[model samples]
Target chain A: MVCIDCSSSSATARLLPMSHQHVALRRFLRGPLNLRPPCCSFPRTFKTLTVHSSASPSPVLAASITSEASAKVIDGKSVAKQIRDEITTEVSRMKDAIGVIPGLAVILVGDRKDSATYVRNKKKSCESVGINSYEVRLPEDSTEQELLKFISDFNDDPSVHGILVQLPLPSHMNEQNILNAVCIEKDVDGFHPLNIGRLAMRGREPTFVPCTPKGCIELLHRYGISIKGKRAVVIGRSNIVGMPAALLLQREDATVSIVHSRTKNPEEFTRQADIIISAVGQPNMVRGSWIKPGAVIIDVGINPVEDPKSPRGYRLVGDVCYEEASKIASAITPVPGGVGPMTIAMLLSNTFISAKRIHNFR
Target chain B: MVCIDCSSSSATARLLPMSHQHVALRRFLRGPLNLRPPCCSFPRTFKTLTVHSSASPSPVLAASITSEASAKVIDGKSVAKQIRDEITTEVSRMKDAIGVIPGLAVILVGDRKDSATYVRNKKKSCESVGINSYEVRLPEDSTEQELLKFISDFNDDPSVHGILVQLPLPSHMNEQNILNAVCIEKDVDGFHPLNIGRLAMRGREPTFVPCTPKGCIELLHRYGISIKGKRAVVIGRSNIVGMPAALLLQREDATVSIVHSRTKNPEEFTRQADIIISAVGQPNMVRGSWIKPGAVIIDVGINPVEDPKSPRGYRLVGDVCYEEASKIASAITPVPGGVGPMTIAMLLSNTFISAKRIHNFR
Candidate 1:
């Protein structure tokens, strides 16, 4: 569980000169990236992501670098920052007008470091957005009843507008029972089946859309990418990310297909997609040839691969081969700077929304 | 509006010689069906459904007709009958053991003749299976509160194991509000958001699946069709049929794709599918060309088409051009004798299942 681009580390990553890396990435993509074979043998279109330029000496090199990368970088970090700013303004206004500060309560019941880190980052995100944050940490051996009691208390607390339970609870506990115990109104994480059901329905709205998928859609909207009438492929069917992502894409009127591990010739569907969102945690599963020309790509998988060159001995990559996909996709999200930052941003935004809804402030 | 093969009429239609019509249909398909082009201009495969036979006039003609139709008829009518029998046995056993009869209460809140007929047929079906039936009829102008009151009463009635509110309430009523009023325990229709949400999630089962989609999957299972690892394309995304049908297919480990009106080049998707379920209301929308060789098709669409040859002046047809699809598909459910009766049969099954779940009966 090397969370190389998790929220805690994304701040430093964001400060790097983006244009410089994009140039280097393009050059690297043109060179050794071509050597890597696709993860699975499948038929793919021969349309390669071509970077248009002329080879020239150092003196004339400056004259040839005019075209941008094949795909526009989605820069989710920047978009997420913009949303957080918007949420911050809204949170301040609500507090000034209604004297109500939005609050989010998070419950963690295990000693998993990844879970703890997620909770800490979420709290930090809440504070940054002017939302009140509450935390309840129980030992790994705690009973399910203990977790339920905390949820019940949070459900009753007027100060808490949103409640989140860090996932991957202890194996001894029934995760469904614990999560269902959260009040639907306070389910900012949107794990409740009622919320999911509403999200899937045409005329209904959920209390909150799950953070990761919501962020993915938000990036597409902010970038003015049209989703309606697009053939989108969502590669994964996990309850939290892939399933809801497909539902959101469909809600926007995209003809959506879900390709999972069981699917044969995954490239056949991928090549037909106008937009591809890969949340399957297999690094570099989607090769360059699998993409339709100028298709948008949103890679949700944050997989860490061994990289002895990096200081940590591992570097983060998405489910797609970024070097290859960037050459072909019309627009794409980068691994570390892409969907990672948006998840917490969405959490804060959901808290503010829940507070407004609960207080009748909007 | 013209329910040509609705549950009420299917009882008599079942007495007709099914094989004789199939032979006639095959002959008719070989002649005039070829003249009918696809409803929408799309690319199609050239594989024709040719019946293998020799050119014998009379003497050898009897021996020449050995090859069967390319696709096997799914026979949803017979399967629905088998399910009804199973429910009947279960109802009897439960009643004998616990002195409790399975009860279904249907509330019809309008003067729509079709709704009234549906209720009558349902009541008749209940009586045939020895399940107690309860009915509440309200005027077309009845207030929403009046309907809610009836729903509340049924919710409190312990004898009622299933509660169904006839759809298309008077325009003045809020359908969502009224439907939500039914206690989820007795929500045999499975329209509640909670039930739908549970159905969408992995490792969660709904109290009831919507009748029609459940029946579609039931037919496939009874026919010994394998869904796991298959590519299934669900045409149409209506919450009642298409959406849940896709969810159900995905639950069974088939990689599912949803093609709706907005989908461009739908034939490309359908042609690759191993199983297709078409619920779009367009008559003859899915052509033989759209089907893959040996694909299993479940046609949920019951559109009415003009037929001066019939007594009704029009006849019920599925979204598929049956003459064309039956030739290409490995197996298909017929328009009239297919998903229509299965809807009511599944309703009975759900009612019985609810009663058993309530009483903790095996």
Candidate 2:
């Protein structure tokens, strides 16, 4: 339960996990260039490098190499729980003060299993935090107009503080058209170009930062990792995770380089990074050799691979090779448990923020 | 005026000049983080290095080293003229086809000589391109409300295709407020957060790309300097030039990194770049050693320094030390004549585009 400062001598590497919820948004997962995925090998054996204590001088390097797991797992589930507890208190106070509960409306157009599971989890989380949750499920063949009508209704509803349209909307639906229709005030997903534009501009601020990237940054702040003046490299340039993540990092005064599929030598850029945020969906693509010693890693790619050992027949892994990265990085996020929980946590937080802003609540 | 490819054997280095127009926007010239300008030495002697032909194999390295000038100057004046010729033809065609002439309206609140000069140059450029031009001049003591009123008028004027408010408004006026008042549709300056957001997003296209950066990229395209997959470093994060320039480079599929004043060891990043775009307003801050052999240099900083030889008592210089950098770079833009003329060229282009879009001429 202890959160150790990443710089401390006793600190163990922490994994910043990728978002499992976004997996169903498969169409959006491709690199920004929409280039064919570069050839990559997966399920590779992990090898631990010799501990170069003097050369690296990392906190983990200074710590005793244990026979058990060396990385002190960053428990996102626990962190998320703590955040929810705090949010619950705030939600109660807002209700007591104003007699208005924050409301989040989700429009799920299709019944993809993963999308359904994500929406259900979000609803349950919303209810637990004392926020009102509204869901509208439509058949897979629904027209774009149908979705836009639902969004317009939610946007005008004074009680609804936030609106989210589950991604990878049916092929027939124009994603941008539907997403753009959601009023900027109710754009809890932060996918609207105007919000994104604000995020990119120097003096302007976005109403909401997209959830998963926001969570990745929150983890860094919570763990007290300094971003200012650091050389950071972001792998992938997806609109959701990688692009915004780089923008956020830059806003924090970090010198950032974006390495996408089109980038010829991604490892060369990653090797120079003090911090690396990888949202590319290729699991274990970032090998140990690609990392700088004592770097902070935030792997936003959660790819599932076959696992006969698991009851689900598959298990999730991050874009980074966790087994190898844990030994080299000062801190990292583990897949499944890391950024996945933080995404929903951030969505709830954003919803509360939206409601508070809308009502002029303190 | 042979526009030699940067990769050619006879390729001469081009100096990408920084914008002289933006210099008067002193308040906006400060870095994004509002960090104090880093203490930097200037007006240093430019020393040429020994030509090691086999070591670098650069085109300039392979070409006969001339004593008078080792690098071939990139004539921004000529290139801009060529682009204007192309644009003029387009404007004539559109006018003939639709009976609509592109009109550009400029709002100049203060009487700063530089701003006035820039506006006049733009007006003249518009005239040369057969686009209608409008000018509104107000006293230096004019209120922001007065400026906003003018902008609102221009916004409503269907004949005014593009609207530009001269920068560095009076100290009492809020710059962002005034800039935001201009309708996004008519914002030829591309300073609108929405336009910036669209520029940053993966698939969305901005109504207008900021002129100076657009000009810099245009110069690159004209010269056939490949941007895709190249390591490009943009120094300075000023909203007008540096930030947009980085985004533009990234959109071209280059692996882009932004180095601001807060960035430690700026040379380290610049040294790694195949293309270096220096927009920081410090004169000659980037030296030859900071550049990689055969790297393309785009100097967007036009800083004034004392020069007894000049009739005006001062001369303009770029952020990069031209004398030293030319030998190392494959191409560069010279100060005053480089990005300066290109900025006006781009403004005319954007204005034409705005008019075309408004009329649905294309």
TM-score of chain B of 2: 0.83
Candidate 2 lDDT score relative to the true structure? 0.75
Looking at model 2, how many pairs of residues clash?
17
Please name the candidate that would achieve the greatest DockQ relative to the true structure.
2
Candidate 2 per-residue lDDT, tens place, B1-362, comes to 11111211111222222243234224223211112222223233333555434321121222222323355567789999998999999999998998899899998887777678777888889999999999999999998888889999999999999998887687899998999999999999898988998999887899999998999999999988899978899987777888899999999989899987567766667767889998876666776666767789998777766555458655667777776677678899998688878888998899989988898887
Fnat for each model? 0.71, 0.71
Give Cα distance to truth, residue A112, candidate 1, Å.
Answer: 2.8
Candidate 1 lDDT over residue span B27-78, tens digit each: 2211112122223222233333343132110111011111234789999889
Q: Estimate, for each residue in A1-362, the C-alpha lDDT of model 1 and write its tens digit.
A: 22222221111212112233222232221111212222332222233234323111001111111123478999999998999899999999999998999999999887776667778888888888899999999999999888999999999999999999887677899988999899999998887999999999878999999988999999999999999988889987777887899999999989898887666656757767788988766556676656666789998866655666568666667767676667667899998899889888988988888898999998
TM-score of each: 0.83, 0.86
Model 2 chain A: ten consecutive residues of lowest lDDT? A2-11
C-alpha lDDT of candidate 1 relative to the true structure: 0.75
User: Which runs of model 2 end up more than 4 angstroms from their true locations?
Assistant: A1-72, B1-69
Docking class of predicted structure 2? acceptable
Could you tell me the TM-score of candidate 2?
Answer: 0.86
Instruction: Determine the iRMS, in angstroms, of model 1.
Output: 13.2
